[model samples]
Target: MTGRPTTASAVLPAALRAWLGLIAVLAALTAVVIGIQYAGHSEAGRADRWFIDPTADSVRGTWRNVALATDFWGEPAGAALLVVAAVAGCLLLRHRRGAVLVVVGAALAVVATTLVKSVVGRTIHGADNLSYPSGHTAFATALAVAVALIATGRLGLGRAAGLSLVLGAALVAGAVMGWAQVALSAHYPTDVLGGWCTALTVVPLTAWAVDRAADSRRSDRS
Candidate 1:
């Protein structure tokens, strides 16, 4: 072996190390978002009030309808459908690893979002319970990322434009859902941001872990 790392370990470590940096950044952002909520910062309060008050009322016509329609993308049923579609697409393309990664990453994201929301204990005016991190936004963001990953893998090299378009559309759709949450007074701005940070943190780390586990399994077989 010439003192070199094995192929599985070498391949996994570089990607995992890069993801660690991203995960740390996202974790810090999530913390800051939640901290602002918990500290009762004026900025957070003002933003929430501004969005939920007159702004919500001002948009109560056609714009509100559009936002309401867009918000469906983040609903539990919609998110589940998106996840299933992404995983099924991967499987149809014979990207079994991608399918597994998407499923694991999305599931972890949901669990993490729920736990964070419980721990943060932030609430919206019309909501029944805590709402620090919006579960709908988290699910939508995770679904978007999962679909982007699968699309990028399928597109491969020499298709940068195609990959970019696919990912951009997915992200834009997720952003629309987040905006809709604010417009509907379902969550604060910080809540949406916190959900996105949690999704970004959870998905990549979950994918890295899944990749490492797959690589280890292959190495064992070899």
Candidate 2:
């Protein structure tokens, strides 16, 4: 006695298709950005210059001081801990499919970021540290993307209500990482860009697929 989709399932098809399209777009855009950076730095002494332009360097130093002085949620460890909490919350709420998607999206974000960074092998703007894809940025982007999906998808949140509030908090945290990295001279603008592209490209499609699967499971039992 299978039946029509539930309120949740009703929106799954269109949303899933949209998400897939978005992921493809995100991937393409990220690739293009990385390519542009590569070409930009391939010239005589350009990579060095772009990575450490004095103007940005000056601003970055000040940002790092703010992070150092406050230590208020600037640690990567704190971000990781939040990931654990997000996953736990989803599981507790019986949003298993969505939770899995969030975790997978995050893991894939890390993998993609690592591969791109390694291939670029570009150093920080002012230091020799690996900096093609800022690791802190990667974590923040991945975590934020995952949280956004949960906030707006299966968890059923309005942008101005409930989970959206939490999502906003997460966004702030994500911004903190990006700002800290840029200000502290830990990464260049391009490094943060790559991380965001990688995460945004994956999260939507992954969430959509999970939503579809969850709908199917419900249909099977009905």
Candidate 3:
């Protein structure tokens, strides 16, 4: 006998749920490990030294300019502009839920990083600076994850395609912003890694929560 048909009220597909669980576990675990290793520290650790060049700046000239351009999008004014544009794009695509996700996800990622930084007590440049996780990197990654999730739903993609899109977007955005932070000496390489993981951990969970809440409201009305 065949199984019952899927309905609008059905929970997330098993493949998608498993994918989310994997992403969340790995991301959160990585962030925690890095934070523990660097807690209450100001200088780059052994792992960080491998990535940082002692004698020369790795990013320079044209590449430095590119990095700066990418970095700008993570700044306060730039991030605000990005949010406005993203929200407009979501509306144009007729995805109000996606628009809300973009706004809320980005804010939560940044806030989460800030709190983690405080607890991690990691610093760079000086004692006053607390930079375990790069907030800029977190913001960029969060935006990308939101967009990817929106695309997945809008296109009605399957498990593999949706997971691929989300992971790819998150990786690209995280790398771009993380590189910028390291090149500018704004944060340690490990800090960037922490930031990337923070978004990876937060965005998917937030999206799931949003879906549940929306579905609950719809069910109530029905």
Candidate 4:
């Protein structure tokens, strides 16, 4: 697994900025989370009775089966740490970052989940905010994105055929876990949305930072 450069410092084009664009999308997602929380909680929000008619509540029964698929989603934080260790091993053994971004990004998702859960302090209702950031979704998306990047190449298979396969798998994995969260009533509709946002932001940041670090090492060598 040889890593390639994807940074300006590496003499690669700046098209990689698209990865950074994920940050902007994350900002918008945060705003949406706040909006939904406020809208669902405020007196004005209650008038609509959104909680009584939640998407997550309707499917709570199906979650047992879903849970089996992502029993590991609960353990994503640990898995993510394992990913980091694996990346480090790859670096040591093969001298490549290999999949550091995925591991780190997944680890970040675990952190983001804890932070949101702690700070939000919003409890779960028929389907409101008990789970603002679905760990299941976050880890699922994180692994999906990271694995895809790993499978492609240093440039991460910036090709359509390759990316589609990667993205498709990620979507399926993410969607399954996300839906499972809803079924279990562990989170709300917006909770999964927040998870997606968190994934988009953290995963790419991890990848870019990993790329930037690798590029820096190359420069030092030169």
Candidate 5:
């Protein structure tokens, strides 16, 4: 009996299996964004008021301080610090691919959010600002997604374990930053949701692209 030779696609077939669910996730994100755009458009609508009425501009004391601190992580200086630390960790682990994924994923997520904001024309504080898909939330969530992906690869986690880690990290990061944005009255609740979904949509795709590129290079060398 003769056996077929394995090709690069066969070897890396599972590379994208981990993110199959993203198809559904991407659809859901799209639907939600469209709904928000139709109803909320350039300003907060009933749904935004429903979520923001109780939480927005109500934080105080220790909570306010915490929110401010969390908000800083999404800022340029704090984000740069985090990126440096993450890159350092990846290098220590000798996971050069992971380091690239972190940097590229974060950059892409932030850029995507900015571009969406301009097109969506959503604003919270004033007309001068664009707030749909809160950049801070997207940045924080992107970092979490990057860390989760790197950990998944380094630890050789199974699909279930990796998925759980990614989702959990994304949720925690998104919630923390989303809460901060709302508390600061910097964005509507829907904007935060958009940001979280944007990270989710961007990071995994980035990871898959990175994997494909690496695998292609390996095949070429072989």
Candidate 6:
């Protein structure tokens, strides 16, 4: 008897299957951003007024210098260098899967963020050009996830404490960038949240795909 034709869904890996919850969360967050934009609500404006206005003057002095430094870390060049360094480190350590995860995760996060921002058409604080998801926050969050994956995979830091330590540092760094974006009035709070959700969704999905690919290659070789 002839077999049924193969489909993408039929070949989906368990690893990817496990990440459906995260993907759902990302979708929900994206929906929230879109809904807010379409509803023509003033909630975002109110949030900006509450968060940005109070901090505007405060971020202008020494805080301005700090914000500038934080902003630099979130810049495209900085994010690229971070990913490059991470991938290089993974390669040096011979963690090929981890390296692949870092590269692919970063790329996916960037592309997803850009696409969502474009499609959602959400603006923040009068900026018409894509602001629903903060690019800086997304970059930082993706970099953090990549770094965490590398640390666990390469360094064998699989213990709960070790994982916590690595992940905690990354979270703190990402949080700082998100806070800076909000304080600088570059994004509303929802934008930062959406960016984080995007990263959380993309990185794990990319990691699952990387692992599945490696497994398939191994199976083929064997």
Say which candidate scores most in TM-score: 3
Ranking under TM-score, best-scoring first? 3, 5, 6, 1, 4, 2
Residue pairs whose backbone atoms clash in candidate 4: 153-156
Q: Compute the lDDT for candidate 4.
A: 0.59
Better of 3 and 6 by TM-score: 3
Candidate 5 matches the true fold with a TM-score of: 0.86
Q: Which pairs clash (backbone N, Cα, C closer than 3 Å) in model 5?
A: none
lDDT of 1 at 59: 54
How many residue pairs clash in all the candidates, one count each? 0, 2, 0, 1, 0, 0
Model 2 TM-score, all chains together: 0.68
TM-score of every candidate: 0.76, 0.68, 0.90, 0.69, 0.86, 0.77
Runs in model 1 deviating more than 4 A are 1-20, 36-44, 47-58, 157-171
Q: What would the per-residue lDDT of candidate 4 be over residues 88-179, giving only the tens digit for each residue?
A: 65565353555456557777876886677656654566333456566678777777766655555534344465557555766786678776
Ranking by lDDT: 3, 5, 6, 1, 4, 2
RMSD of each: 4.8, 5.2, 3.6, 5.6, 4.4, 6.4
TM-score-superior candidate, 1 or 3:
3
Cα lDDT tens digits for candidate 5, 110-171: 99888877777776666777888789998998899888777766666776776788789999
- Model 3 spans > 4 angstroms off: 1-15, 54-58
- Lowest summed lDDT across 10 adjacent residues in model 2 is found at 6-15
Candidate 1 per-residue lDDT, tens place, 1-222, comes to 233333222212342345445554766576566655564322246655654563444358888998887777667776677778887877787776678867787778778878876666676553346777777777777667666655544544224543454347446755777888877777777787777777777766665676677666776766
lDDT of 6 by residue, 30-97 (tens): 74665456333323656556555633443678887888888887787877788888889777866677
Off by over 4 Å in 2: 1-13, 16-20, 39-76, 125-128, 154-174, 212-222
lDDT of each residue in 1-222, candidate 3, tens digit only? 223213222223334767877888899999999999899998878888898863456588999999899989999999999999999998886666788889989999999999999999998778889998989999999999888877776666789998898889988999989989999888988999999999988887877776677666766666
List the global CA lDDT of all models.
0.64, 0.58, 0.84, 0.59, 0.76, 0.66
Which predicted model would earn the best lDDT? 3
